[model samples]
Target chain A: MNEQLSMRQIVFMYLFISLSPVLRQIPTALADESGRSGYLSPFWSVFLILPLASIIILLIKSFPSLNLYEIMVHLIGKVFAKLIITLYLVWIIVFLTAKMNIYSLTLQFTLMPKTRSDFFMQIMLILVFYALLRGSKTIFRFSEFSLGPILLLIGILFACAITRLRTDYLLPVSTINLPSTIKASTSVIAVGGNMIIALFFADKLGISLTKKQVKKFWFGAIFFIIFSFVITVFTFGITGAGLTARLPFPFYITVKSISFFNIFERFEVIVTLICILSDFITICISFIILMKLIQWLFGLEQVWFCFLPLAIIVYYFSYFLSSTQFEFNFLYRYIIVNMNLLFQYIIPFLLGLICLLKRKYIKKQY
Target chain B: MIYIFGGLLLISFIKQKDVILNKKRNLVLFLLLSVCGIALGTVHMISPYIPSIAYSLEGILRTLLVNR
Candidate 1:
């Protein structure tokens, strides 16, 4: 029997991939773009991902048993499909390598002061390699199990920080500058490009996603991301949030700023550990999806063969790209987002359109 | 550092020995990937302070975006 993932597993998959950014530099990037109005960006971004997710689900449903890779090959020729997959693979690997490295760097800065960051990355990668030895299904199951405690702990932290949250931080909804707010929202929406990963396993999700299920899928994932981001933006407020621009991971900074009942202190350690877990989950899943894409690219039956080789490339690239956190910020903020739009949205939208037209032509002929 | 990677590759080769057996193409993909990884890793270890493509892209974006 083909490996089948439950709807919960599928939703959790979207949840982790899309929201992984909340742990790292994405929060400050949002704040730096628009001070007070930055909180609104997540809402705009979630709303943006909805229709795109719907289109992708519909596209997958139209081509029974075929994932995005297979659908691309069926619609376009194999050569063109492989070409597209090559470009898409480069985009994903470079983006994820930065995540792997910078999160390790953030560890060096926040959590592990004495240890080398690559050591952390290597250990994490070993765990990922073991988990992925079977294939892509392990990644989904890991997400299914790992997400519960992470959300619970993060929720407790947010609840504890409630008294510290300043709605005033989100103030003057009208005086909010329009242009920068839009720019910030676009950046946030760029993370929504992660909705495309759902397409990778759309055919294997086991259950057909109904319209309501699709709505729930996108909504649930966006909720975690937007909620965490809103809490962070409000916790830091307009003025205080500026401090996040300098911090490696702003969520930690927000958790540290919180004071619980004037008695408990240093809630940040637990929160940081939990976030590091979430970041690890994100990196693992990214590498897993990369493996799946490579299998499709080369028509290889045993993709596990290339796993170690690709891991080596990923580790090396992570080092090469880890020149500075500034590079991480620049890659995420400037280059990767635009690539997300082009590769994730615009190209797939066109492909779906062509598929629809071809289906209609075939119907008219019959 | 290079020695460390070489050792790691050897370990990976040993672990994948079964998969590597009678698979000429797979061997080629592994060798090519190892070469690419070693080349990049060596460059990074030697320089340790190169301006990445991200910086150049950021410069281009700053010119185009014209943050107002």
Candidate 2:
């Protein structure tokens, strides 16, 4: 098995992990905020996400050998770095629990409504344990391989739904709604900012990066924007903004309208499977990142000791965080998105500013 | 359910015994976190109907900000 993750692999991982949220959260959020013009929000998000992506690329290029933690230590001193990482540890724990809760809730609402959520969470914990035991490289590789087919399935669904598109549902955008579209882009920015996850694994990208690796990072960022835009457009175009806003899983419901030659009418099953797969990968990667944060914060030589305990805590806390879909939405929109913006963009922007100030010093060191 | 968690914790500790033995801090931290997990689980088992922190926060935020 491969041990180290390449920049390409990391990019694929970010793309893969963000798929779950892009599918589940962004469409509904956009629809809720901007109605028919919600599809345009993804484009407005580029104004924020593009700069943030550039900052990430700069940070990784400047400090090729260090992860986010070590980069923080170098840029802002050890004490502050540890303090920030400690805060990260807290945020990730909550984030991981939220991911778990959402995954379970998704399953409950879609697949097995009769089964208790704790059962789903328990099974998910076992799968995550097995994946982590195989090592982080396996998780990255799984994402690398899975992303292609997942995108292909989405593409196929979009093609099928093309016939169902109602232009009236998507058009008639007035200049008056432009402000609401910009406001709704917060949902897009919240999910897109997850690209910063690349930094957490930067140390694994090795010492020197080639131009090809940098190009891959840009490809990943652009691909993410296109993916979000296309998904939102399809959801709104087929399902309509009014229904999209009302439904919890707009994309899932949108997929139900797909009929491939009248033989495959139940394509919504594929949507559920895709969601389950996306959520699984997301939870595993988030768990790995959580462990990495703990390792960095506590200076642990082996993270396995705390692994089981942390999983147990996550399993229970998933229930504690949000028991129902309503609570989950409130937590996600009010708490998690804002928190993601802070940690993923604001803090990284701060680091980029520090890197700019110490450019010559950083260059001299390496 | 608690028994399952206990067994898993025991197995994890046994699997990492050598490393935890050498690094006493890891052992302490492991036990501390495990105890916390078990405590949370017991509380949850006792009353699963408890409104989550999100619920409270939503109520507070809605009243404080939205209601105003």
Badly placed stretches (over 4 Å) of model 2 are none
Query: What are the clashing pairs of model 1?
Result: none
Per-residue error (Å), model 2, residue A350: 0.1
Whole-model alpha-carbon lDDT for candidate 2: 0.88
Best prediction by TM-score: 2
Candidate 1 lDDT, B7-58, residue by residue in tens: 9789888988777655776677678778887888888789877767777677
lDDT to native, each model: 0.71, 0.88
Clashes of each: 0, 0
CAPRI quality level assigned to candidate 2 from its DockQ score: high
In the range A1-366, model 1's lDDT, one tens digit per residue, is: 158765567777767665557656566876788776666666666666676776786676677556888788777879998998898899888877877876676777777879977788788778877776666677777777877777786677666777776666667667547666667877666766676776777677644556666666766656755665665564556236567656667777677766667777787787667656667777777776787787787665555666666777788777666456777777777677788888878878878777777886534533
TM-score of chain A of each: 0.90, 0.98
Docking class of 1: medium
Q: Per-residue CA lDDT of candidate 2, range A86-106, in tens?
A: 889888898989988998888
The DockQ value obtained for model 2 is 0.88
Best by lDDT: 2
